[model samples]
Target: RTYAGLPVLGGDLIVHESASGASRSVDKATDADIEVTDTSAAIAPSGAERSALSAAQAAGDRKTGAEDAPRKVIWAATGKPVLAYETVVTGVRKDGTPSKLHVITDADSGRKLYEFQAVQNGTGTGQHNGKVTVGSVRSGSQWLLKDSARGGHRTYNLKHSWDETKKGSAFYDADNVWGNGKPTIAQTAAVDAHYGAAMTWDYYKKVLGRNGIKGNGKAAYSRVHFGDAYENAFWDDDCFCMTYGDGAGNKKPLTSLDVAGHEMSHGLTSATANLEYSGESGGLNEATSDIFGTAVEFYAKNAKDPGDYLIGEKIDINGDGTPLRYMDKPSKDGLSYDYWKSGVGNDDPHFTSGIANHFFYLLSEGS
Candidate 1:
């Protein structure tokens, strides 16, 4: 069954076969049969093609009325074969009867993860026997769970340290609140540290293939709300850590995803180009962070905050309201320049920074 433009992660064929039948999967489903209506319309990089979903069969004893286990298949995608994430469909059936949904990992390889069942929850024309999601997972890291309708929403947090040797962790005060003076769902410290750690780990592992912030494989520290009314977030080479300030007007926390990616990318820059923070090189330095920061956002693909060209729109750096910078047309912000020019001393990092910033945009987004 299809929901929205994204293809349901799994399909209904699981029902016709016996509950304990061998896993039979199909990778190619004709567009006509599925009736896929893509809504996101997100374009892929040049020459990139998407992988198709296959209907799989389960394995088990088929004779003597023995129940046959459900088949498993992996939603695999790789860098060479780039594809947008597939939308997985979930819900229940019409008669309030629960349908079994299984997630089998490593289906290609005989080494499969334990099969877990998912419950179906829906009724009438909208009724679906199983759930489907269009996403891929890392190999050797597969899981199976019962259909959701059988129980509650299953929430997961991927918390792997890209650099295991890195030490030091930041903590948040779950009960503390900032400017508004009201209690927060979580303390500022925890939020800042959580993102900082995740960014540092993901950047090194995914981009540079390095172990951690210090290619030597060491952990860094993060602190939030250093003092009253802090207005910026920064990383200090001396401290080898980062700090954030609560926004001045509203009680916005400074440890936003972009900010964290920005500050952390600085460490990456220092390690490589070591661009002097005073001239065009300096502008390149800042753009480096923006580029990687934006990349990280795209990699995450969080439903509420997917990737885009804009930077720091969440922080609200503009006193009135606007992103801190614009890659497509840097000058759109008025405070920053659009093109490069000679003698533009990096005196105003924000102003002299336009050229490289715009260049990175073109490189990533294309003209």
Candidate 2:
């Protein structure tokens, strides 16, 4: 329930019911005042909207659009109740990235309070393990790329387009098995990605005791072949999905097992710590994903791609036949810092991640 359109916390309430259906309740939780005396706003709705748009613009949002009127509500999340106007702004940046931001402003002062992005922007394998087992759903006479056992995990093929309106079709086959252990066939990459997702789910469930990425027993989906000549994979929070791209010339796909785990771990990080993607915190964020990605690789114990401290060893993103990064001795790559020092936060996350990755490697495997 809410008071003056503000959420009321029930953490302090205790209710007792008798056999006659009479109920008694005691309130002991809230001590802060919830009254709002300044209902008469000094700033108009247009002012609030301007403040929100200005805030979004200051935060690097371009092509900004917002609601004409802000909604009045009580914000009790901070334990201090305050009347505020919540404004939602949607737009894309100069880089072609989309943004859906919610801005909160003081109803009376029109001062911005808080804002957050709605889209979560943040995979892998094969040439990977030889042959792997995957969980799939059998419908009629077809084996769909849906895992019924793990909250119905599904994988779709985007057919090299970035548009979400035209969703890629789900992979289905006559046989229960998938992938040919090669990248020549499109299904081969899908097989590796599907298997990687399953292994990641198992790793979290069996090793960490987490049911799924969100720990809510819900499985996220994956989209393969995201764009043309694309050589990357990413996890999007908005769709709760992981997307993979085909490497140069459309021969290699970035769907290796460790890559899958790495991308999925980003989702886990966002759902949990939400480590800011910049500065020292951003380094920690990238390292967290690398740590878990390595863990998942070892957990799978596939012979073809044995567990190792190197990342993307199988993908060979570099034409020189080298992994994207190294953990055992990060400096081997000639760019990553093997040890922490002052101002490490200034470095790119991929490079700064080396410090934590090295530490985790030493902690888990030891020198």
Candidate 3:
């Protein structure tokens, strides 16, 4: 609508006299127009699916048309119980992010309430005590690396394949135990990836008060061992998953805790401001990832992977003990700028991001 106003419902009948026809008559709704027959409250949001379906069946499929549980409500005008159901219709949002809707219905009459969809922020939350634990399930006799608690955030084995489109199989084990203190085995890296994801999810939920990466109660899956010694980790919007490469010679998997947090923050940024990945906004984009990544690492004080402001310290992308980017002194990388200059935006985002990274560091920690 152009603007919000009083919505007029079903008032079409109007007649004008032939002689001196100025404004003759209009048909208005009376008490009988909205009289409720069954004003009962028997069905709940769960069981109200039948009523929700009956209400929304005209728009979409009879069974699946009810996007959410029906909501019960009384006609405000009549001050009577006229339960109506408002279900979320099918459609992706403008930014292409998924939409969610909930519904409730009257208990007795089974009348559905009004349907609606809204962008609810921080709807879901996670709990991580900074411990090395995996949320998994038993299948037949094996335990799969799946986090049932945090929206089923799972880690898969790409088998050193480069196909990002394919979601590799789960890292299953006969015993629930995983890893042996090395990245040689597939499950070893899977644990790192899965655990890192859990920590990041927890950081966002507990510290930042976000539901998930998208703030939509959904988890982005992780793909480990994406390529042969690929030496890279990336978050793809298309796949909506984190892909980690086995570092040079397949010795190191780029599944560090801070790195996971950093990657997921990109999705967060996309869902929010959607800052363009170019110019000053691009640098801010990269800096946002680093900031939240470091925050997540700090929030998650796991002894194995302790918190630190240094980004990507465990992955060793530089072939030395040094991390990828330093927030305190980005110039240490030899390519990043310590401060923003007139032409800083022309440089690479990772390099130009040093300015913001340095600022966040100084602001958070002290000069």
Candidate 4:
């Protein structure tokens, strides 16, 4: 029988149902116009096999031929759900910084398609460079960094807030000298709960079809300015929220879309497929956030900040007029690795973080 609107290919196998209420597989290579076989199970596909077959069929570009592939005799035999959808985040930040993040998720279940966070912004901080935390939009958390000179240790808090005017929100420096300009810490988180919360809420609802961090359809919490010149942003599952640091030397804020999305995606990762951190898995975990964060920017569709593949495009950490991270090729950063190889140590979690970072680059950008 002639099939219209179908992509037919040689070597393709298809099944046909007869008037007798029976099904059979017919190999296109040799079958007659109307040939019959027996039993769907005799030609049924198993989950593991089905995925391979689907991939092969897709690669073969046999869109029409595969249409007739027999349905698994049993649903289990058919294949894993093809719920994954590719999501790409592409745009440039307001200051002309390039940014982009990619994600893959189960289209039906609304599960993550894929995630990755590469190094976006970095500044020298003791043994660690400036860091970006990717986790849930949790709430009710605080941090206290040592201030021996102050006699009394400095205390910081984390809270999530919402605002309609800024077009975005953040976990800001509430009490830091740099935060709201109290002038105690020397630097303050430029963006506050408004930006962080805006990113967290926007990314999930817009890209992943998720309700919130919990996927229960609720708002998240955030806090800004957690310490004296605190130089980082983080999301802690235990705390269930995020915290930010005041900029360094009056440079930039830690609440950009990539940073906020990175932190928020961490929470989503923890909630589902909690990929282990510290090694290859850890890198994958980090990349997941970066990917989602970039996507969030696109989903926002903010004309002011069109999305792109670069992370931390605005908050210039290097001061050399370049992005903190490049998803198309992460090695663009002077420090970040392009691909995985030997000597890639387990020493620093972020250094080792390159493995998944590379994986995501390949997954989203394609090798």
The CA lDDT of each predicted structure is 0.47, 0.79, 0.70, 0.47
Count clashes in each candidate, considering only residues at least 3 apart in sequence or on different chains.
53, 5, 20, 57
Q: Which segments of model 4 are wrong by more than 4 Å?
A: 1-193, 342-347, 352-355, 358-367
lDDT of 2 by residue, 11-106 (tens): 234567778878865554556766667556677778888988898898888889884567776654456667777788877655544566888888
- Per-model TM-score, in order, reads 0.50, 0.65, 0.65, 0.46
By TM-score, the better pick of 1 and 4 is 1
True lDDT of residue 19, candidate 3: 78
Where does candidate 1 stray beyond 4 Å?
Answer: 1-189
lDDT of candidate model 3 versus the reference = 0.70
TM-score of 2: 0.65
**In model 1, where is the ten-residue run with the lowest total lDDT?**
123-132
- Local distance difference test, candidate 1: 0.47
Which one wins by lDDT: 2 or 4?
2
Q: lDDT: which candidate is best?
A: 2
For every candidate in turn, the CA RMSD to the true structure comes to 18.5, 19.7, 16.7, 21.6
Ten residues in a row with the worst lDDT in model 2? 118-127
Error of 3 at 134 (Å): 1.0
TM-score, candidate 3, is 0.65
Candidate 3 lDDT over 1-367, as tens digits, reads: 0001212222223455657777776554433344345545455555666555554444343224444444444433333435443345443334322333434344565544445443221111111212256667666567777775577788889999987789998777777777765765777777777877877887887677888988887999999889899988888889888998989888877888888889888888888979999999999999999999888888877776777778899888889889999999999989998997898899899999899999999999899
Best by TM-score: 3
At residue 221, give the lDDT of candidate 3: 94
